[model samples]
Target: MGRLSGKVAVVTGASSGMGSEIVKLYAKEGASVVAVARRQNRLEELAASLADAEGKVEIFPGDISDKAVNEAMIDFAVEQFGKFDILVNNAGIMDDMAGVDAFSDEKLLKVFSVNVYGPFYATRKAVNTFKEQGNPGAIIHIASEGAYKTCAGAVYCASKAAVVALSRNTAYMYMHDGIRSNCIIAGGFKTEISTSMGMPNMEAYGKLKAVLGTAPEPGEPTEIAKACLFLASDDSAYVNGAELAVDGGWCAS
Candidate 1:
């Protein structure tokens, strides 16, 4: 049951969805967790809920796109739990449905900053933290099927594709240092990002859901959390630079 015993993990986008679920599961499996998100109250709630679990949970509120914040997160984890062992780069946002003709520089930059740059910043700091301790660590990045297919807006798809590349590069760069990196290519799920982007009503959300040809039932966040656990734990010690598709077979189509 102690899959991550004696581990310390930093999870971004922990306010809700897969990030939140990962925090809970990690703590349950015996890893101290630092949950980072913009919503302080939500993070607090998560920490409180994890009280009495096998491992501790701490809340760190910040925007992940900021390099300083990512650095601070690593520092805090080291300060609070000694040395960091895992990082789950799960924070992401959906872009407005716009093709190339309708895309704006602002939109493109914002998505790339969060989905691409944010992970880069976090991975760098996490690797540095691991290096400082001379211990091997694991990095789990939550990418999406949009990375390979045009399920979402052009900008969103491009950003995810970049994330896949980033994860692979991180794995290769740190292979000699015992730092492993992997990407989870998630399929359509009932995430806040998927359900609330320009879909004014349920009907509109449903229409877009149908058009995307996603599975009839969206994947639950817990499903993704399980995959994160594998990557975070020693179970995947040899699995690096791997892209595991956790979609509901959406990528198959």
Candidate 2:
């Protein structure tokens, strides 16, 4: 039951959905966790709810898109615990389903900032923290099916593609140091990520809905969390640079 005993984890986007589930499971499996998110109250509630877990849950409230915040979170974890062993870059925002012709400069910037830049900043900090500790660590980037298909808007798709590339490159770069990085090619799920898409482009949404209509039923948050646990634990010691599709066969179509 102690899958992650003695490890310390930092999970971004811990306020809800898969992020919340990941925190819960990691704590129960005996890993100290620092939950990072913009909502202070939500993070507090989340940490309190897991008070009886085998491991400890703490909050690091801030917008992960900020570079300094990213670095600070890992540092906070190390200060609170002895060292950091895992990083889950799960916090992300969705983009309005806008095609190339209708791309909004503001939307492009916002989506890239949160979805792409947030993970990049967090990864850099976590890698450094692991190196300082002289321990092998795991990095799991929550990518999307948008990386390979048109489920989301062009910008969102491009950002996810970049994330997959980041995971692969990071895995290759640190293979000699035993730092593993992997990407979760997520599929349709009943999550709050859509709330970020303020006023989606109608034409683009229509096309996306058509493609998604053929996909399998949406998955639950715990499903993705289980995959995260596998990657974070030593169960996947040999699994690196993989684009693990957790989309329930939606990507096969």
Candidate 3:
């Protein structure tokens, strides 16, 4: 049987990139997935593509930045699939590569709203559901190496740091309740998230050149999705509150 056989999972940002790969992987491994994202057509295509997979994929088209959407996404998973077991808080946005002095309040809000607040709301709802149903839960927050390294703009860095903290805090708070929360410190990867960066401050963008040079070739989304699969399955039952740096040794450099 597949690793996630009979599991029900909620994966945000499932319209494209890493989120899409995670949904595909989970379904292939036999998990019924609620692919949540804002693009209705993309979600429909994704769900249709998985029609022959070992499990099922249903679309939840909405913006996770809204608290109601986050809450409803989890509830939708349970309402549609009978129960909820995993939540991959993978929806996030990036900020322009600007320094603190060059950053704007608007950018900070936009970044944190999608990156931090969305996860916060989704996690809160997931925790309650897990406790009520008395089933083990797994939450994988897709953070960035920027959380600890100067690989991104100040706002992006700060946002991911919050995500890392949230993951650890949730893990500690719910360890005894059979819920696992972990952060994946990702390195440079080829994904559509760059579309959200908009534009970077030319001068401040140079700040990342040095550190970016140390990074290996960009990784594929499936590579990270594989690690997520491990954490989502019973394989990572003992691994909680961990920061698994899937960064190809870039952070070491």
Give the winner by lDDT. Answer: 3
Tens-digit per-residue lDDT, 63-155, candidate 3 = 988999999988899999999999999998889989899999999998999999999999999999999999899999999999988878999
Report the C-alpha displacement of residue 80, candidate 1, in angstroms: 0.4
lDDT values of the candidates? Answer: 0.87, 0.92, 0.94
Count clashing residue pairs in model 1.
Answer: 0
Between candidates 1 and 2, the one scoring higher on lDDT is 2
**Pairs with backbone N, CA or C atoms under 3 Å apart (clashes), candidate 2:** none
Listed per model in order, the count of residue pairs whose N, CA or C atoms clash below 3 Å is 0, 0, 0
lDDT of 2 by residue, 1-253 (tens): 5899999999999999999999999999999999999999989999999999999998999998899999999999999997999999999988888999898999999989988898999899888878888899999999999998998899999999999999999999999988999989999888888898999899989988888787898999899899999999999999999999998898778
User: How does candidate 2 score on lDDT?
Assistant: 0.92
Work out candidate 1's RMSD over C-alphas: 2.6
How would you encode candidate 1's per-residue C-alpha lDDT over 4-103 as one tens digit per residue?
Answer: 9899999999999999999999999999999999999999999999898999999999998898998999899999999899999999988776766667
TM-score of 1: 0.93
Error of 2 at 180 (Å): 0.3
The total number of steric clashes, by the backbone 3 Å criterion, in model 3 comes to 0
